[model samples]
Target: MAAAERRASPRRVRTALVALLAAFAVLLTGVSAEAQQRPRTVLEMLFGGGQQAAPERPAVRKPVVRKKKVRATRPARQKKQRTQAARPKPSGQQSAAAAVAAPASKNENAKTVLVAGDFLAASLADGLSNLYADNEMIVIEARTDGSSGLVREDHYDWTEKLGPILDEAKPAVLVMMLGSNDRQPMTVGSRSLASRSEEWVRNYEERIGEITEATKSRGVPLVWVGMPPFKFDRMSEDMVFLNDLYRKGASSVSGEYVDIWDGFVDADGAFVYSGPGVNGQTTQLRNSDGITMTNAGEDKLAFFAERAINRLLGTTLAATGALILGPDQLPTIQLPPIGNAANALQAAPVSIDDPSLDGPDMLLGTGSAGGFSLEPSPRERLVINGGGTGGTEGRADNFAWSEKSAAVTPSGPPIVSRGSLNLQSVRESGGLKPPEEMPTILDAIIEDWSRENEAARPE
Candidate 1:
């Protein structure tokens, strides 16, 4: 009988065991099949029809065709298998070459700087290096002050001099402060100097036009700091004329015209040192000098240059630096051992733990008084027991003075109620409301103070 049972449909029992095991495994996981949120595979999500193995197409039923939803796949992100046929495969060399040839964008702060001038330019270049050393900017300034790089003359090798600086620096701004020693007559290559100042002006215009062309081609904005009148004797006339020529040239360029000349020039525009002509700051606002400027003169000129730089850059140069010598580093300026001005420099830190701090500038107080010993201004305050009559836990509150009160003290007896006391003439102002013959608590306090004062008096 056992053998016959074994042969009787063992496949049925095996099928039942698989179903029971599958159900038991699902149950042990502690989530019902309906409660589980199994994420569909990408292909199943898009194409659908992935349920219960493929159902056989029955001959008795009509054919079912399901349209697939089109998904927007990024062409650049096609899988490797798709890439195998969808696009041309490039060699490693080709990818790198393409990357190298791509156009790149530049930001302002990342651009280089081309500074052109004499030794002053060199110092500026150095200062800038130290100034922007921590920043990201390149600077180039010539060390030579022997010749001015004016439009033309013996030292007309600007392309050799300034050209290389511009090329290497690849500057977005051309900072030029020139004509300090350009007394040699202006010329066009090998041509003669302009006859009259008017012709000289026209010829100067043409030469400047060339310089502007060179600058514009490089996509650099020119910032021309024009010459200040020289501050010496002898060749003052030639120097003054040269300055005017510089002014005209500066105006000709599309760049900003930094009128540093005015910072040094006299009202008449001639060079002088004293009297009505010298305008070198200390020299008064009267005259222009051959060369040099006072500290004030230099400051004004520097300010002019700073403004032009700001305008060209479309914002402040964005200097982020500590002063070379901060007040903290230097001896705190020894204010005169006495002066009201001493108050101007700093504000002493103060915290208001003692509320009486808001009292009269100069005050008299007993050991029991909580208000300050002195105050700059008389301030009114409310006190429940601070008047010495209220509860022991007196509250001091800032309050406005009552207008009706006739008398007041700078700091008064603890104010028990809302009322005004004249900051001045308190004894006379706060006299008792006279009665026929009775006395009040105010009377008692007064009597006590009087007795104390009498006892303290000399025997």
Candidate 2:
């Protein structure tokens, strides 16, 4: 029975192989029909024949559709360029000029001074104008905003406004002073900071730097006038800090910083409302508000700034106008003639015979016992007088001196005249000496005392 089953399995396998061959022939016929309807590549056929065949008509390149380039006309381009160039560049100075009106006619040779800043700057302008009023070569152009500061950007911005004025005025020198109205909170975009805060100081300095850079870019010198002391102590203190920022900012850009703080302060650094005027009399420099300056105060402020301006301009124009008349053009001095003035000498030798130097003709002591003589005596003698009552009051002492004789010795007693008084007590006391020696009065007195003592000794 097992052998019969194996023979039956072989016949079954042959029947299964014939059925599989029939199915494969049916799939080939279906693919050939689809290929004949539409073209297909080897890659498309391998990829399940989803993609269409590439169109082949000698591989046409679509005629290379090159666009004809339209070049601009040289004349038109030049005209457009000229129009653009003709329009003034909106520079800092130009914008500043547009914001602030300036004079139309100005001297080309004159030195233009742009006095710029806040309220303080207005006074500075006035002072500078008056200072250079006599000088035809200096033209003061004032560009000031009273209600402006670096803090208030909404009202006025110095960094944005200065460029235009600088452009139109073309100042040879810039005199600037601000920060008076800046002692408050500053708002930059959404951020707000109090004055003197770290952020605000940094921002303030940046604005000053921008202004400084703009001025220096034109190769023009700048003079930054420092804020003066205010009437209030706190206000003055804030000004000090602001002035420091100005000094550093101006100095960093090779500009001059004119310190005017001390000019408005006392020795103790306190703010003074009424101080010494420029003429040395006490005058009000600041108003009752203690912020703005008076006319005299403005003059003083300009006095500080003028020093820096004069240095830049050299003041040569002022010197050129000074009139220096020669001696020929001056009036001659007329002096009156003095009596014997031409013969008079500043110094002269002493003259013994001059009548002006002669002694009086009348002699002294003439009415007395003896007359006084101007002439010197021929004989020389030392006169002494004892208290004798007979002599005249005008008589001098009668002590006579004699020249030495060959027979007389220098050590011998002096010879006495018969009329001379003899001190008898001296002779009795063994104090008497031979003629030719002079006796002192003390010796005579001692001898007289000795004689008295000897006599009184119980004899």
Candidate 3:
């Protein structure tokens, strides 16, 4: 029995040890779980004393894919085919070229208009060219030296060269726009004369005469275009002086002078950059420099010259650029012969003073029908003779106090006099009763007060 007891005790001791080990294992597992959940301190981590928690991995989002929009593109082969189809055909190209060259070719036989002078004349020629571009009957011949002037004979002698130019061009009209560059000194032989001096003026006038003589000798009409006002006040003043000279020179040779001053000036006569254009709309006419003109300005500058040319040439240019010849050049029309000229009625000429123009030989009141009456007409007697229109016996105008007896008809009732039936007699006979008199203000007020009293007395 003792040995069995001893063996049972050993088994009991082993069970107790196994239970303690299980409890210790459970506690260690709980501590490890807590350590994992709680974050470690800096000291604990540095000392490596406590178990450090592993960092939780961040949630990874799925990548979102977008669909790409596809475009319909033509193939290179189709694009090339379309481009080739768009190309102009050979016939079309030829027609366009012909159309472009038509104006230049048509002007080959056009009458030349010789434009001669300095830089302004060159610009004038350009303007005139544009003006007559569509008119095939006229051609502008620019014989201008941009740097040439009457003062600078050494640079270009216009007087010496103008004669040859006129001969060469054989211009229908000579358009001269000079003196823009003539403000400089003039060289008369060995002396350099100041501009606008007596000697310079004489020399300038002589040069002008030379140009005019060339045109006069050639029998070409002259049209001298005056310079426009510049931005510079001094320059504009100089232009005015030059224009006066131009006017006299042109008039000396029976040339026409075109005054373009009012065209480029404001209401106050100052220079302007923008103004009423050819079409009358406000547009920029002068360039920024104010010495030169814009495209529109050039066209307007030509407008004055155009009128002179039209008058000198005796030709009217239509809006469509057609040239209408003068009356002398018009075709004569012959009328066809009548079927019977001998049977045509012939009217004799009548004199206005014969007094038979209105089919009356004598006045209506005159007794004679064939001869003129020596007696005056009633109107003439009233106006010239101070006569009165004697009133008729039965008329309303008769003011005689004596009452006339009614005229008796042979088979009818007695005729009543018109004067007895006048408005005064009718009123006396009570034919038209007079209007009743209106109540006075006092009576109206009294009547209103009586009505008020009656109302107050109570109905």
Candidate 4:
């Protein structure tokens, strides 16, 4: 019995030791997991590759250098992105923040002008607006779409809306481009600006006068964009007429006519979208349908335009890839054309007070003789007037009539709109398919082309 009790005591001691070891092991595991949840530097993350242990400091440096370039190549937009990366990038969007912090500008920088049209304007507006890189000199906002006839109430009264901003900004430079959507006709004088382009010519002259006067009032320098060519499929001939008007009219203003088309225009005013290829084969600069640009296209445009503006502002930026020193953008590796310097600008386009009740391209809808018409309405000539969208989902119809909308035509009235077609019974009826994101090739082509092409010309 004594032997047995003695053995039992020792056994109890061993069991306790085992239990304590188990508890200690569990505690150690808990501690290990807690450490993992804490923040780590790039150094701490280096041990992930089946690494049983962390390497010393000197060992990490070389690997990071090699990996960085490789990882950066994952994106193709590195040209512009590199500049951004060089800046102390804050957590979210740096573009919006940069514009907000940019101080007000003064001097020729304000007057030194560059202008772009629609899609290009949108790109520039978001991409290169008020960068604060150029000291108190450069200011540009190009966001007018030509497809919408730029009348007083055109596209949210852009001229009116921009009036206060322009006045307050007191720009010395003004660049203008528009007239793509002037396909339809309206009356400016007692005459119609319709299929009879001669009438349109007079109206165009009068309208341009209004714009030039506005710029003069503000003492802004002016650069005017002439129309570029569209693809042969959609607007080959019509574009020529309009482009010609742009050339003649732009010349009339005594404004610097930067014929965006001429530099890129072919003998037939055709636009090729690319630089020369390796072989003698000619590569196109624009995309397949001829309006939107590829990457190289934008690169050339940005390079030239930025250089022009940079020179106008008299910043010490080299159009060649020269890195900037203190308070300057890096050197641009671009070659821009040096033309005769622009003349001093005068005033802004002033509103003319004619008793005429005409918009740039307002239509009186005659009932449908509809064969391939751009007419958006049947009963009343669709007034393709521009205004606020006012939270309407399918509000475009209120602006212009689109026969292309997926809305079902009512057999009853000839006066239907795009928004109405989208919002109506055929849409809401049972078993009807919901709207799809499908855009036809033509539609896609036009939309894409217009955006890129428009970027070169804004209202």
Q: Pick the candidate with the highest lDDT.
A: 3
Runs in model 3 deviating more than 4 A are: 1-104, 107-109, 325-459
Query: Residue-pair clashes per candidate, as listed?
Result: 23, 21, 0, 49
Q: What digit string (tens of lDDT, one per residue) describes model 4 on residues 220-285?
A: 656665555666635546656666665565556555555455545566656666654323345555
Q: Please report the candidate that would top TM-score against the real structure.
A: 3
What tens digits encode model 3's per-residue C-alpha lDDT throughout 1-459? 999999899899999999999999999999988887788889997888677556899999999999898986523211111123344668635443422222333356678888988877877887788777666677788998888888998899999999998888899999998777887888777888998999889889898999899899989999999999999999999999989988999999899999999999999999999999888999988888888777778778888799998888766862235666557856674434433322223566777787666686766788523433455655666799997545557766566555554553245543456555566567589786779999999999999999999989955
Specify the poorest-scoring 10-residue window by lDDT in model 1. Answer: 76-85
Q: Write the per-residue lDDT of candidate 2 for residues 1-459, one digit (tens) a residue.
A: 999999899888998888888888888777766666766667877876644454777865667778999986323111001222245775663553433322223245888889888888998988877666656567788998998888898999888888877888898899888888888998988998987888988889899898998898877789999988877879878988888889998998788999987788788877888888878899889887888888889889978887788777666444232333457856774433333322222457778887757765557755324334433232211123333323333335323234334564456556565556666667788886678876799998999999999999995
**lDDT (Cα) of model 3:** 0.79
* lDDT per model vs. reference: 0.52, 0.75, 0.79, 0.52
lDDT for model 4 comes to 0.52
Lowest lDDT block of 10, candidate 2: 76-85
How are the candidates ranked when ordered by lDDT, highest leading?
Answer: 3, 2, 1, 4
Ordered list by TM-score, greatest first:
3, 2, 4, 1
